[model samples]
Target: MDTQLIRRRMARYVEMVDAGDIDGILGLYADDAVIEDPVGTPALVGLQAIARFYREGLGRTEASAQLTGPVRVAGNGCAAMPMRVDLMWNGEPCSLHVIDVMEFDDKGRIRSMKAYWGELNVERRPE
Candidate 1:
């Protein structure tokens, strides 16, 4: 797999998220893709589940993510993209430092995406 291509794809993914294009975002995933946001939540598998997850997750507020650093890729089709998330979670504005580890399939679509974040990564956004 071309690492540069994957990096570019991830960059586009972030852009899609920031743009609130749910369908466009889901297009990057393989049919059987799995997402484990924050790594502990039950994984959302398949397009339907993934779509539902993002619809509620992204629809909740004015959410946007900006890349904080380089996209790191491994030889085995895995990449780590660090980003800063600004959103209004449950009517409360907040910021979070996040890293999404995406594992791509041979077709170059994301097969798995696991987000790493924690309570300490959460911060209040000024009113």
Candidate 2:
């Protein structure tokens, strides 16, 4: 698997996610892909589980994320990127800094994705 190709694919995936295109976002993952979110439960496996997780975890919120820097590719088609998520949660504005790591399978589909971030803090707006 080519690391550069994985990086490009991941960039597109992020774009689709930011656009709230769940189907497009899921297209980047393999059938048995897994996701591990820092604030969520243990590994979410398989496409169905991943889809449910995304819909319930992220789709339920009005949030957007942007990659803060260039992606770094490591061995075995693994890539990492720093990201910032800004959004309104529970009627409060929140911002989070996180690092996302993705591992691609031989077929160039994402096999695993892991996010590392601090606990989210929601702040009420002053009017």
Candidate 3:
């Protein structure tokens, strides 16, 4: 597994997110990939679960995300990227800075992803 290749693939995934191409974003993960989200309770596993989580968390909310810097690969098919998320949550606007750690399987598809971030502040949008 080449770290550079994984990094590029991850970058493409982030780009898909920024473009609001949900299907494109989901296509990056393997069928059985797991995602540990900051807000979700249990780890979402498999394509269906992952899609549902994203639909509720990101799709339903007014949100935008961008990768802040280049992805850093650890030479073990693992990579991390800093991201900035702007979104509306519970009728409030919020911003979050997060680091996404991704692990790729032998086939170069993402096998797991975990996002680390601080608690978000819930604030009503300015009228």
Candidate 4:
């Protein structure tokens, strides 16, 4: 995929998340996509697993994400975006700083997504 296209897609991902558009978010992935959020957990394979993961997480929470930096494109068909996500988790307001690296398939769909964040990157928001 072209770097510009990937950048646009990454931006769209943030827009969809902010809009709480799950279907639109999923539309950016390939049928057999794989995701490992925060990168060490078990991978969520295929669209169904991915859907369930998002539905149970972001879907169940009041969540919004913003890109903190420009999308960085790699020589390979991959791009990464820096983001800050604020959401209601377990009835508490919190935020996470994340960097998501996505590999795109030939069709320009995300074939793999690996999020880089850890507990240190998470912060509790004061009410």
Candidate 5:
């Protein structure tokens, strides 16, 4: 796994999220990719499921992700990205600090993504 490639891809993923490009974000995943956002919910599997997840999530509000730290890449085809997600929900602004672990396939598509975040990490944004 090329470290630079992984870093570049992950960085692009962040950009897509920030831009609210659901299709662009979904394009980053493999056909059989799985995402366990927050690590406790039922995993979203495959492109269709992943698309639904992003749609419902983004539909809730205007959302964006800003990197809070450097993207960490390993020798393996995996990387960890730290960021803060800002969004409006129920007419209230909210923010969540998150770290997502992404595993890539040999083809450079994300095979798995697991987000690490909890209620404690969430905050109400000031109006």
Candidate 6:
């Protein structure tokens, strides 16, 4: 896979998330893709489960994510980015510093995504 293409896709992921474009976000993944947001939790498999996960997390909230550093791409169809996600969680405004790694399928769609984050990475955001 071309590293440039992987970088573009990685950047697009953040853009779509900030725009709350659920469909666009889904389009980034393959039909059989899997996601492990904040890895260690059970992975969400397939587009159906992925759709549910995004819907519940976004849910009419002003959620947004911004890349904090350049996207790191590997020749092996993988890329990772560090980003800060600002959103309303449990009715409280907060932000999380997260690093997300994604693997691309032969078709260029994301095949697997694993987000690395923990409670220590979270902070309250001023409304």
Best by lDDT: 6
If scored against the real structure, what TM-score would every candidate get?
0.95, 0.87, 0.86, 0.96, 0.96, 0.96
lDDT: the better of candidates 1 and 3: 1
After TM-score superposition, what is the CA distance of residue 43 in candidate 6 from its true location, in Å? 0.8
TM accuracy, model 5: 0.96
Of 3 and 5, which scores higher on lDDT?
5
Question: Cα RMSD for candidate 3?
Answer: 2.4
Tens digits of per-residue lDDT for model 5, 24-118: 99889999999999899999899999999999987557888888999999988989999898987557899989999999999899999999999
The TM-score, computed over Cα atoms with residue i paired to residue i, of candidate 6 is 0.96
Q: Candidate 3, 125: how far from true, in Å?
A: 8.7
Model 6 is weakest, by summed lDDT over 10 consecutive residues, at 56-65
In the range 1-127, model 1's lDDT, one tens digit per residue, is 8898799889999998889889999999999999999899999999999999999888666789889999999988999999988998657789989999999998889999999999988898998
What shift in Å separates residue 60 of candidate 1 from its native position after superposition?
A: 2.5
lDDT agreement with native, every candidate:
0.91, 0.82, 0.81, 0.92, 0.91, 0.93
| Residue pairs in collision within model 2 | none
Candidate 2, after superposition: displacement of residue 6 in Å?
A: 1.1
Write one digit per residue (lDDT tens) for candidate 4, span 22-100: 9999999999999999699999999999999889888988889999999999978899999999997567899999999
Where does the lowest 10-residue lDDT sum fall in candidate 1? 84-93
TM-score of 4: 0.96
lDDT of 6 at 46: 99
Candidate 1 lDDT: 0.91
